[model samples]
Target chain A: MREFQLIEKIFKPLTKGCDAAQCLADDAAKISLKKNEELVISKDVMVENVHFLSDDGGFKIASKLLRVNLSDLAASGATPLYYMLGFSKTKDCDEKFLREFARGLKSVQDEFDLCLIGGDTVRSQEKFFSVTIFGKVKKWQILSRNQAKEGDLIFVSGTIGDAFIGFTKACESMKYFSQRHFFPTPRIELGKQLLAKKLSKCAIDISDGLLADLRHICHASKLDAEVFLTKIPFSIHAQKILKQVQDGGRVCSHPELVSGSKFTTLDLLSHGDDYELIFAVNPKNRKKILHLAKSLKLDLTCIGEFKKSTQKKFEVVLRNEKNQKIKIKKFGYEHF
Target chain B: MREFQLIEKIFKPLTKGCDAAQCLADDAAKISLKKNEELVISKDVMVENVHFLSDDGGFKIASKLLRVNLSDLAASGATPLYYMLGFSKTKDCDEKFLREFARGLKSVQDEFDLCLIGGDTVRSQEKFFSVTIFGKVKKWQILSRNQAKEGDLIFVSGTIGDAFIGFTKACESMKYFSQRHFFPTPRIELGKQLLAKKLSKCAIDISDGLLADLRHICHASKLDAEVFLTKIPFSIHAQKILKQVQDGGRVCSHPELVSGSKFTTLDLLSHGDDYELIFAVNPKNRKKILHLAKSLKLDLTCIGEFKKSTQKKFEVVLRNEKNQKIKIKKFGYEHF
Candidate 1:
């Protein structure tokens, strides 16, 4: 779709109170100030062949992950008001590139009335895009990465690791898991719905691997976590395929499969791909949180608990064949 | 000199409420609910090689031009709030590479308290950084890029294009113009101090060359402009060197140079170096604006007036031997 058409078809319907004929049509965006509430804004970058690849399917690459960034605002339960977009126009960025990227951005913006405010455009040898989203919440009501308590239970929303499995399957044969990999939905609905109600004192998106990210909350909160091994959610189809892979003689050589096995179904708990929420809630309020998730029509899963710092209980635990707890110091994925 | 030290030396000591340290040092930043203001946020990218190359003098590449991005807030009278950063650590990025980048980023951040809230890190074949800044302003005072009046006078803060010359000089000898090219002072003091009072009806940073950016404001405001050629400020040094170059035949033979003669001093004016404010003010408030600038200890120049639009006007007038207005149709540097 053309730029204007893409906005018209996808973005125009999403925003509110914007001077559409002017701001959306022009090169930069316009701002209107409404008082009360603090604004919490953030920007993140996703690079081609770095954070994602063209082989992953460009259309989905452009769209699904856009939701991943938007999910940050949702995690804070801040109403997304607008966005400033930065695009790296690479050689591979042609009509299709522009069309899909625009479509993805427009659809996400529409989902939250996140207006295209102002950003920069530049040519690069490779493709990349960074979007800054703006949102607001009552200062006290907003959740953060630093507020988890030791006694809180770690919970997640929706299914975990399905996206990772989807990515693997897509790589195996461009089939079956297109939607999972391409249009992985952000838990915006669940995130926004969870705001201000203090069941999970701390929150963040599962953008990086799950275990790696949980460590972020733990580190920030200055607490230790003890995730139950069996409670981790594994999709039914994924469990079956993984079993077959494990039974196959060649499975051990494939690191992901063994990585999956070494952790039992639980380390999949730590493996990334679950865009589901991984937040902290007090034991007393667990029922309330489950009730809230059900009311919001989002799945709620309780898989772990945060404990007071042990001079050293910060390990990812998995049950061994001997029924002993084995610690894996290296979690799901390591960052560059 | 180093990332951690820079954060400790410059940013750590800054006055912050109990929340700043708790929230910022963690993976996120926190805001106490005291302030209630409308939020106006934006993000801009400056890619390496694409936006600025090492040849562009490390320090100037570090500091000065980045202000062009901040000028967006100044135009809207929004205070500098916080900045989100994205830097790709390339193979070429050694300690010195980081030092310069950090120095440049620190200078701007210090000036604007555009606190470092959150960002991403990655490795690239090339080094580049993109920044997204968030600011706040009251509802009534916000400026839109598309809101110029029919007869509004177009004014710019300071002279246009010095940064442009510094850019060229940096290319010739990075060590020579490093001050001008690398450490571009973002005029934040002037932006914050003046626009906070609503002296200008509309304002925008002169990141792109003057003529094109003015066109944008005019287009957005639904008006046409008639800028005076003589009023356009050219630095004394720019005039001397350009005239010398033209006399020797270096510039005289080129149509691009000859055509852009009216804006010739543009190495300062037309190039994107001068991070000055280009804005439109209602004719009635011109005296008040001048008065406000004088009180604020800032330089405010009335470059030209915005006129009714039947057609576009070429305001960068030059004089021939007969002293007639010389035509300068093609305008300043085009980023795209």
Candidate 2:
């Protein structure tokens, strides 16, 4: 079957009750919004061997791709309503891969209550997955990184460095950490709570590690940031590994960084694929933000603080226990 | 520079004054719709070697990708607004290529007054371009192929078979046809006119050739159609090449079928890449549609009529000058 036929057979069924999808028969889909609602849009692309392992199953790849886009939506405190998928596959791709991909999408549809409205499937020399997610938020209620205010306390949802650690330990063991790297849980409800309740002024999703994404917020907001080494949140597994490295040994840590105090914290903060929310809240709202995090049963940490940029250079400073600035050779994940 | 930094340097400038874009710095962009407007969404993907030549200029590739998605929006009678782009390039792609690509996008932005809100740029093994465009239309004004009636007159905007003919003669010296294949003008205003004035009941953009896209319309509407071969519109250049083939010799035609009267019309109808609009209109509203077409300075042709499907098998029949059914060896472009 051709690409359109395959879409009709395998993908159209996923749009059952979504009137906006038009049963995936039209050239485009129509979505109507309420008077006070605005659309939150984002697009993400993943390539084989770059975003995921070449041998990864189709289901995992598909789910991860969609979830990453959802994570972006979650950052904006938008409820995802619809999405368009662009699947470009190599010539050797078979029907089984497509079926499993569709199955993966169905799982996301059930989990998020969002449906695919429109998309394209094309043949390429490489396998690629791109998704453009449509989300809805009340007018003027959307969160943005550029809205961060000076003196605002920087907060992050969930543990940091888990995904990076998982990626490091993939070959050895640490299946849980590895799975965290493979599948990320987007903080949708927490983001909505923060935005809807006006608890936070700015937000960003941590895909390029903590330091890099924090710098993004600082850059956009025309401020600088100072992250406390002791305040960075870590899961029990990540903490245990870090403790091991601190005790005169390093295993499954970054290969290039030398083992010890100089490299440990910065390494954890620079490696990416975390898929967690990082937001800025006023110091007065810290207690309420903590309460919301507790009600949601999620680990929230005040990792850093935004400061005025004297030189107009957006920067992130990592401070050791002595409150002295640590020199950083690199900032974060470099896409080039 | 890293990918995000490159984005900041190159792309952020393109989003000037588009408040919803957030300067392309945020993880997601926010857009608000008017009280009576609905969002029309479409996506299209293009890959090197499959969709275009590997050596094609970045400007052409970028413009083509955006235009095809715009064509989808046009078919739905939506005014183009914001778009998100996903660009995946191989390792060899450099700054110059990206600059040209951005210039190409600037052309479209200038033409349509649309802006890029958010997107992703990734490194892949092959060049891939995917765009998801969000358009606006009045509530309940979206057009679909499923609304065609049995007695509706089938009208097509512009000429047919030009792109296919262009593709066939690309190796030879047919610059006009070749350019037509590279760039297709989306009937944005004409589509809006048809939808707003209620001049047509159902519509589709002819991307996969006349016969194939017509099949899509017929299948959706539960009807069949009879297209008069003599009535199919053709450009002056397309007619010249076809005439050369009809003069007892076949040149630059498809290799699968033996040339002559049997294969000529079927081949032209089935091969795709023509980005014209094919719509169905009531016989009572034909005069108004024609007048609108004249006012718009567009060539609109009544090439066929939809018929009730006897056995629920949606089909298209091609008739010769004598009105005899012409057998077709193949349908349209099938991307398996």
Candidate 3:
């Protein structure tokens, strides 16, 4: 199919019920903001092999691309509204691939109540996708990373390290962790509730792993973070894998997955792709925050707290079960 | 440099003077709109060796990327505001290349009163760039392709096919047409004046050649366009090349540049990359539009008129200097 037909047949339906899109027929899309509302925008780019595996299907890639950007809005306590997708298709992207990709986008849009606005598509040797998502929040309720107070308690939603485990397992053709790796929950409702109740003012999504992302908050707020390794929440599967690796049990034949190698708990904390949110809350709202998480059926763990930075530099201190500080060599993934 | 350091040292400065950008430190950018103001957004993706040459400098590529998207806003009669860039860098994009790219972005942002909001940068094999530009237009002043009326005089800004000539010549290491191809002047002021003075209500940018883009207006408006070949404006350089080629004189040693080859006036009309605005003006407002163009020191020519479609399908009829009908086998470029 040609470019115009591909858009009309595969992507145009994603803009249904969105008057601002103009059926993707105009030179630009028009968006009107209501009074007292502010628009929040974020963009994320994913390249084949670098961000996602080359063997992954188009559906998984498309869904992950949108969800990652949505996670950013969730971090900012914003409601998903609209998104524009920039797709560079490789030679392997046939009509079937585009249809599946559109299906994935449709599913996410339906779930999040978001609309596709406008974007550009081109042919390229490398397949990559960039999604710029728009969301809305109250004018004064924007949640930022620099708003964390020195005494604020650090909270993380849902269990961590599942995505990292999934990534490693997916490389071995293991479907055990594929769902967690391919599909991520953006936590939009949690973000909205946190803003509506004025529970938190600082938050960030764990895209570059927990340690690296929390360091961002520390740097922006000019504070230090004290995280308890034992307090960090992990799913049952992650716990099993941790125990097996610690006991020198062979989990897989992959070089990185060898018994007691780099797949330790510390390494998991440094690996990314988890879409859960890490937020800062006042100590006074500790009980209320837990109750809020319970009501939403999500596990909210208090694994750390913010402290005044002595050297005026961002620092994250990880403590073991015995209260001994642990040394970390690498924080997380770096694109450059 | 790591991703965070690269962003802080290189891309962060581009967000200066824009409070909504939050110094590019936040997860997402915030934008607040005034009453009766609508946001106009357009995204364009350019891939190396496809939309641009592989040997093109980072500065030229970056500037062209911004200018093309700005041209879309100009076509919609919107004022430039902010933009988000997605840069996928190849292995060869060293620090020098990044600095040059940032410098280009700074130049365009300063000239157009635009700000860098937020975006993502990643590693890729094929260097590509996606720019999503945001503009603002009064709620009811947006010019649309579907709003053209029958008998409306089709107007084009500046000269056409100069960029096409530049593209062909640049391939042969000729710098004569480089400026026109690399640095296109988006008609932002002309668009604003057209909207402010209500000179036209239908317009589109000439990126996909004059005939192809005109066909877009015709298709969207459900009308047919009749363009006069003699009325189309051409630059002196383009005119000279056309005469040389038509008179059976060799213009260059390149195969395509040989006398009586594909480098004809009609071929120029079929090639793209010209960032000029094409609008439809009411016959009564013709004199006013001419005056507005003169005030802006821009060339505006009446090339054709929109008419009711005879077969209910989009159609564009071309006429030569001798008033003979011309046949077009192809419209313009298509990605797929």
The CA lDDT at A303 in model 1 is 76
TM-score of each: 0.84, 0.94, 0.97
lDDT of 2 at A62: 84
Every candidate's DockQ is: 0.36, 0.81, 0.86
Best by TM-score: 3
Q: Which stretches of candidate 2 lie over 4 Å from their true place?
A: A1-5, A170-172, A245-263, B170-172, B248-250, B253-263
Model 3 spans > 4 angstroms off: A170-176, A251-262, B170-176, B248-262
**Strongest candidate by DockQ:** 3
Cα lDDT, model 3, residue B171: 30
lDDT of 1 by residue, B263-286 (tens): 244345455655567777888878
**Who is ahead in lDDT, 1 or 3?**
3
